[model samples]
Each structure stands twice: as C-alpha cells, then as structure tokens.
Target: MKVVIQRVKEGKVKVNGETVGKIEKGIVVLVGFEKGDIPSFLEKMADKIVNLRIFEDSEGKMNLSLKDIKGELLLVPNFTLAADCKKGRRPSFQSSENPEIAKNMFDKFVEICRKQIPVETGIFGAEMEVYILNDGPVTFILDSRELFQGGLS
Candidate 1:
C-alpha cells in the first residue's frame, strides 16, 4: 500500500456533481494498494499517519502529531498513485491491485484510521474531484510495503 498524505485546512471530494466526503482542518490521504499488500501494512500505515509530527508546536516547530491537534482525515482511494511510467509516455497500472482486493484493503485502512481520528472518505472506484486548502503545504508519501519489509529509510 502507498499513500500521499497532505495537510490541509479543509478538503472535500465530489463525484458526479454530488459532494461525497468532506473535512475541516485535516489531512487528505490518497491511498493505493498493490497485490501483495496485507493488513499488517494497513496497521502500520495508520499508526504512522496518526503519529506523524507534521503539525507545528507552540514554538512553531514541526513537533505535533495529528492526534495532538485532534485533526480529522479525508481518505480517498487512488489506485492511480501506483501508476508506472518508467517504460513509456503513457503510465501503466500493472502494479495496481485488482478492484476487489483494493477495495477490501481500502476499507480496512479506513477502519484503522477511524480509530485514531475522524475519517471522511470518497467513494472507492468512483471518479472524484478533490478540493483542498493546504496548510503549510505539507505533503508526504508513505509506502506500507517498505514499512512491512523493514526497508524504511
């Protein structure tokens, strides 16, 4: 599983001209799943996301975690994040997980994330338009596969 975490003052997702999920002052999580991904990856990613110290402290230092700020989360399923472009001008999605497995893992990840903070989610497999008001423009990429393999560097 891979995720792009963006700190935002507000975020919302719309599909087919209808609003689906929205959040206020939180992180926008774009999640991607691969074939070999497992629950262990989901668990670790959730922990890392909630505990990541990206928020500023009293002294204006990046020392406060999402939990510390009691922030919410906007989770969006994005298999496109796994797109492979190494070979040609057009990106390939061969690394992406099948919809069934991806949906299962996406739900599992959302469930785990909900335990830590309030979570809002876009419809899985739906075309969505996301709106974000970024804070500090902070963004991060996390690969649960790396964490599971003890390959985090």
Candidate 2:
C-alpha cells in the first residue's frame, strides 16, 4: 500500500459536481493499493498516520500529532500513485491492485481511520475532484512495506 499524506488546513472532494466528502484543519491522505500489499499493515498504517508528528507545536517544532489537535481526515483513493514511469513516456498501471480488490482495501483503510478520528472520504473508483488547502505545505509518502522494513528512523 502507498499513501501520500498532506497536512492540510482544509480539503474536500466532489463527484459529479456534488460535494461528497470534506474536512477542516487536518490531513488529506491519498491512498493507493499496490499489488502484493499486505492487509495486516492497514491498521498499522492508520495508527502511524494518526500519531504522525507532522503538526507544529508552540516551540515551532513538528511535535504534535493529529489526535493532539483533534484534527479531521480526508481519505481519497488514487491508484495512479502506483504508476510505473521508469520506462516509456506513458505510465503503466501494472503495479496497481485490481480495482475490485483495491476498493475493498480502501474501505478497510477508511474504516480503520474513522475509528481514530472524524473521517471523510472520496468514493472509491469514482471520478473525484479534490481541493486542498495545504498546511505548512507539509507532505509525506508512506509505503507499508517500507515502514515495516524500517526504511525510516
């Protein structure tokens, strides 16, 4: 699984010109399911995201977690994150999970997040227009395999 996490002041998603989900003063998370993604890491990913110290504290240091600020979350499925662009000019989607499997995994990820905070979501596999007011313009890309493999300190 791959996720692009953005610290945002606010975010929203619209489908068919109708607002579907929105959040304020929190994070906008774009998630993608890659082939061979482990489902067990879904919960771990949720825990990591909610507790990630990407928010600033009084000392102007990144020391606060989303739960500390009672922040919301906006989750959106973005399978394009798995696009393979190393070869031809056109990206390849062979690394992405099948839509049927990915939709279930996306739902599971969202359910896990909703348990931790107020959660909003873009419809899985829908044509969504996402709007974000990024806070600190802070962002991070998370991969479950990397996290489990101790790729970061």
> lDDT of each prediction vs. the true structure?
0.90, 0.93
TM-score of each: 0.95, 0.96
Please name the candidate that would achieve the greatest lDDT relative to the true structure: 2
Please give, for residues 53-147, the per-residue lDDT of candidate 2 as tens digits: 99999998999999999999999999999999999899999999999999999999999998989999999989999999998889999988888
Residues 39-132 of candidate 1: C-alpha lDDT, one tens digit per residue: 7888788888988999998999999988999999999999998899899799999989999989999998899999889999999999899999
RMSD of 1: 1.4
- Give me the runs in candidate 1 sitting further than 4 Å from their true place: 151-153
